[model samples]
Structure formats: structure tokens, C-alpha cells
Target: MNRLFPVWRRCAAVWVTGGLAAVLSVHAYAQAPTQRPAQSATQSPTAWTTSWSTALQEIPRIAEPPPLYQAPAVAGRTVRQIIVPTLSGTTTQLRISNRYGTRPLTIAGVTVARSAAGAAIEPGSASVVTFGGKREVVLGPGMEMDSDAIPFKVTRGAPLTVSVDAGSDAVMQAWHRIAGRVSYVSSEGRHAGDIPAAAFNVRFTQYAWITRLAVSGEHKGGLVAIGDSITDGLRSTFGADRSWPSELSRRLAAAGATPMAILNTGISGNRLLSGSVCYGDSLESRFEHDAAELPGVHTVVVMIGINDINFSSMPARRGLDCDTPHKVVSADDLIAGYRRVIATAHRHGLHIVGGTITPAALPPAREAIRLKVNEWIRDGRAFDGVVDFDKALRDPAHPDRLKTSFDSGDHVHPSDAGYAAMALAAEGVVPGAKR
Candidate 1:
């Protein structure tokens, strides 16, 4: 009876041990697939993305505006078919600004669509834009709002037309005056989602309220061109994106190199040291906002000071009162301003390339200062690199004047060919750009 009891106990212990091992193995097998999916969700490829932006600024109302600077205001009406160029991306957004408005700017509705023809949208491509998931947005004075991302695919260099209906409360609005492109305005109706070009009758050359278009994609960074009228595409064909910076963007894309977006922050009649109500803020004051703070921006190309030198000598030419202070600045003063720009850029970890002031028909006094400044830009080593714009656009026969072929007949600003040359000269120095 004792031997039988010992055998029974041994068999019972073996059976219990085997049963526990089998239970643990089944539990581990059940957990294996669940763990793998969680790991993969964390390692998703969609995590890598960037924002490419088009920077905008306020256009101060001028007292005696020229024919081209006459951009009308928006109130109780729909501004339809404002065409804008953007960098390539899978998703898109809109930035509306009221930075200089005295009252709250109320936007009733907005829409974006693929541009089909003049003031027309492609079929079934229009998307409603919202702010925080709401269609109506009210921006307080000196404020900017970004719309929620819409699932819209955009190709490089393709134009998108944005439509807006500014409610009756919107008054004293800001604008991009020298849009260099055509936009259509409707006579008091909410045609933001319409597809017909016939609904818009009043043709204009300005972008109102809309500040920037941001896109999501894979890109290294952005390149910003900060300058005066020359960089503003003054003489380039209307509605054609022939600005030097635009040309540079096309060149970069054609090379099939690493992706980089270009942002142009040029304002016509702008000066580097002085801020006039009509010419926007001075480069010294606006540097941080325009050049340094831009999203995905790492390289800045600067070309200014011609207006600083020219306007100082002839303030009356632009109908300015000669009594304006700080009109005349020496070469040293201009160089000092350049240094300040460099310091600000460096502090923000931006790689700045200085562009030599292009030649124009100037008085000897102004020309001498331009030469001195150019010499310092080339030899002083104050910038990360230098783009010799003077050498590129100046006539070898007469170094003080613009090449006759490149001149836009005003002895200032560049023709289409000249703008192309400027782009070529600077392409090699753009940060992360493949030369």
C-alpha cells in the first residue's frame, strides 16, 4: 500500500507541472500579434513632414498712388479668383491677416480650388476652408489666422485661386499691393464656391487679406529673398511669375535636387534703414519677422540699399518731402545696417548671403556709395556667402550702369532676361541647394 501511494504522488506532480507550462505558452502566443501592430504604428512613415509657406506683408495706403498701386478695398463683397503660386504638397492651408486693421476683420466664408482658366476653377476640386473647424472667422486687429488643413494635392508651380467674402464689418484692411498677378472681384455676392468666371467682372492686380499658403510635404527647408523693388518683380510681366526668386525656384526644381521652397519678402520702394508709411517697414525692423521667423526657412538672400542711396539723393522724385530725416546715409552707414541684418540672421541660425547692389542710373554721389558698398560686400566677409549681382547684371563696358539689354528701360529693375541671370548667379549659394 505504501509503494502505490508514492507512484500516485509522482504522476500527479508531473501532470500539474505540464498543465502550467501549456497555459503560459498559449498566453504568449495570443500577445505576439497585438504587440507587433502597436510597434508599427509608432514607426509609421507619415511622421516625417514639413510646412512650406508664402510670406505676406501689409500694404500701407498711399496718399498719391500710381496707376499700378490702386488696389481697392473689400467690404460686403466677394473677392473671387485670386490666383497664387505654391510649392508642391499633399495638404494645404490658408493664412489670413489683419495686421494693420483698426477693427475686427470678419470673414464670412472662404474656398480654394485648382485654377482651370481665368477666374475659373477645375470641376469638383473646390474645398471649403475653415478656421478651427468653423467656416466663419473673426480676426482682431493686428492678428493672423491659419485655416485647418484640407486634403488637397498640389503640384509644383500650379496656381490655386482663393475666394473670400469679407463681411460688412471688415474695414480698413491690409493687402499685398504689387501682386504681379491678376485677381477678380464680384459685385456684392457670395460666389466663393462658384466655378464660373462670368460671376467676376471687376479685374484687379492685388491680393487682399490672404497672407500665405502653407503646404505639408517632405522638404529640406525654404529660401527667402529679401530685397527692394528689384526683388519685387517690378518690371516682370504682369501675371507671370518671372521674379528672380521665382526663376530661382524653377531652376532648383528643374535640377531634380533636394526639395526646397522659395519665399519672396520684397516690398517696392523699400529702404534698408528707414521705414516709410508707403514702403512698408525697414529691413532693419522687419528682419526678424520677414526673414528669420518664416517656417522652414534656413537661407536668406538679401539685395537692398539702392533705394536707400537713391531716395536719399532724390526724395522729391517719388513725391516725398525733402524734410524727411535720415535721408542721406554714407557707405559706412549702409555697411553697418548690413552687419545688423547679418547679426539678426545668425542669431536665428539662418545662413544669409549678401547680394551686391545692382547698378542703376544714379547720380555720381549715389553711384560712389553703391560702389563702396559693393566692394565691402565682396571683400568684407560679413555674410555667409556673397552673390555678385553687380557683376552679373552690370555691363562690363560701363560698370556703373546696368547692362542696356538687362535694363527695364527705367535704368532700375531688371528685364526678364536680367532676372534670369540674377537667379543663376545666386543658385550656387542657396543653402542645401544642389548647384
Candidate 2:
């Protein structure tokens, strides 16, 4: 896909070129960890726990990429993003990546400050973000780097304005598409410390470069909500913390449950079995990095397999066939996959929970698979615990469909209230969580 090893226009190997000359000279070095090494429990208590994060996907490789993949030009622009990181943090650190890029991604500088309003940051709260004690860093293909810890305070769900000034000639090639939050980009030039929000003219929701924000703390571990678009909180109200995981976070605070980060690692269209260029690597392939490898993740709740069951029916597109591997799945195949994931979590010494597939008004045949899978999830006792999301949002009258009040209108994704209900159901099952 010319994404990893770029295929340049070399057919014109300079047919008797005259005096013209062009040299692509870009030099920047990245200083960050590909993976934050897990802290041993017996070690010192001060460790890093991810405060907030979203999954990244290699942009769809098709020539005519979709509107969503048309990542805004960041070569010489400053992008100001409103990061929603309310998980506990005292001494915070950041992660950035060029994990799927052909061209190097470089940032001249990054500055974080308390968000005031749309694209506006609090005047005096700005702090510089450094890498290996330096301001600039470059990431080559398949690389992710974490920043040096910054002494900033991000409390329970407060918003943060992360301003990044792209190094000269940097290009973006990977992104987290369903940001479900608002962010802005400057027209041109560096605006990393622009507190007035005047230079940030362009706006977008997708997140680029930056990945995880972790805080070194003595707090309890976190809960990771990992799944498909439903878990991604798709179609939920934008800029509002309406995702089930967010709602779960709210409940934890209200109930006085042990304070832990509720990190969301769900990617829209992601599947448990098949891989897609559009939706990230299959969960079975990415589970380690996305879930098990995070610093202080103690529990993980898995809600997937719906896409694995339904994508087989989607008609193939001529260009980007995101539905490929159209490999139809049976209940047995999914149950086997779950067992593998469960074993992996156990190996990592993390407790894993299973969530029943929620209701989606599907045709009878496919619906059967979902029902059977949920049955196995409940009865098989594969996970350490279970969260019956289907029971929470399904219509009592129809069992096969979502409650009308819970439907996000497409009949698959959940509405805000529906997500809240999911959170409530999850609260009851996760031990000690009572709200």
C-alpha cells in the first residue's frame, strides 16, 4: 500500500535531467519508548497509569482515501487538540507515534495547558512537553515514543488543550478516527503557546501523532473498555462524555469506588478475528499493546464479535474492501477466540471480564449467532466475571432488538441513556463498584 516502503514517482529516472536538483533532507530523532515497560508489583509504588487514550489505525490504503482518512496537512501547522483525560494524574507523561507511517513524523514542540473553551486554553497553565529532555523528536515508520514526564495536574475528568507544532515537512499517516471530541488546527506556522486560540483556524476531530497520556501515581490500577464501535461510543453525543466507559468512570467517582482510570481502547470497525486496513489489526493480534501492556491496567472488559458476525454480509466495495476476509463466524469460532484472549490476559496477570453482545436488530440468521455467543459468554464461565450488556439494553418485549429508548437511531449503536445503562450494568458486576 506504499504506506510502509513509499513508492515514489521514479518512472522518470530523470531522462537526461539538466541542472535541476532536489534533495529531500529531513533530520529529526525520536526519543520515546515503543512500549512503556510494565512495572513489577514488588517495585516502588510510584508507577504510571494511563489517564486517557484512544486507539490508532493506519489510514485506509486505498488511493482515493475516504473523507475521514484525508488527515489535515500538518507539515508546518500547529494542531491544538482538546484531550479528555480525567483519569488520575499528578506527574504526567505523553506518548506519540509514527507507528504506521512511510514518512517520518516530527514535531517542533508540544505545549499542554488547561482548556478554557473551544480551542482556547487557560492563560497561565501552559507547560512544555519534552522528549529525552529535548523539545523536538522524529518518529520513523513503526515507532512510538513517550515524552519525558511533565509536572502537570490533570484531575478527575478535566479537559486539556494539547498544542503540537509540526516540525517542518512532517506528514501524518496514522490516526484515531472516532475522536468523539473536538480539536483544532492552525492555518500555518507554530502556535504551540498561542493561548488566545486565534491562529487555530482549521478544526477536526481525529487525533494524530499523540497516543497515550499517563501519570505516575500511587493510585489503584485502571479498567480498560476494549471492543468495536459500540464500545467506541459511536453515534453518541460529541464532546459529551457519553461513552459507557465514561459513564462507568462517573459511577466510580459517585460510588466512592477505588479511584482507577477508565481507559477506552475501542476502535470502530475493529474485529476479534479478521483484520482490516480500515479498522485496526484484529483484537487477537493487538491485545498485548492495546490492553495487556498498559502500565496500570488491572481489569479489561471485552465487547466484540458483532462485527465478526455481521461483516461477512456487507457487499464488497471495488476500491477499499474493508469487509474482506468476509469469513463468516459461528458461535463456536467466537467462543474459541474468547478463550484465547482470556488466556492471554491471564498470562499478563490481568483479570478479564466478558460483556454480552448488545442487541442489534439483525436478521434472524445472524441474530442466532449473537444469541448463541451471549449464551456461551454467560454460561461457559470463560472470563473472571461477566457484564450482561445485552440484558441491560435489550427490549424486554422483543429480546432480539434494543429497547426503543436505547437505540442510537441506527438500531445498533446505543444512545447516551443506553450507554449510561450499560455503565450501570457494568457497575454491578465489577466488584466494589456500587453506583
Clashes of 1: 0
lDDT of each: 0.70, 0.79
For candidate 1, the TM-score is 0.84
Model 2 segments beyond 4 Å from truth? 1-46
lDDT of 1: 0.70
Candidates' RMSD to native: 18.9, 14.8
lDDT by residue (249-301, candidate 2, tens digit) is 98888888887888899999999988898888898887878887776766788
Q: Which stretches of candidate 1 lie above 4 Å from their native place?
A: 1-70, 81-86, 315-326
Candidate 1 Cα RMSD (Å): 18.9
**Per-residue lDDT for 374 in model 2?**
91
Give one digit per residue, the lDDT tens place, for model 1 in 22-67. 1111000010111101001112123122233333445545576665
The C-alpha TM-scores of every prediction are 0.84, 0.89
| Worst ten in a row by lDDT for model 2 | 1-10
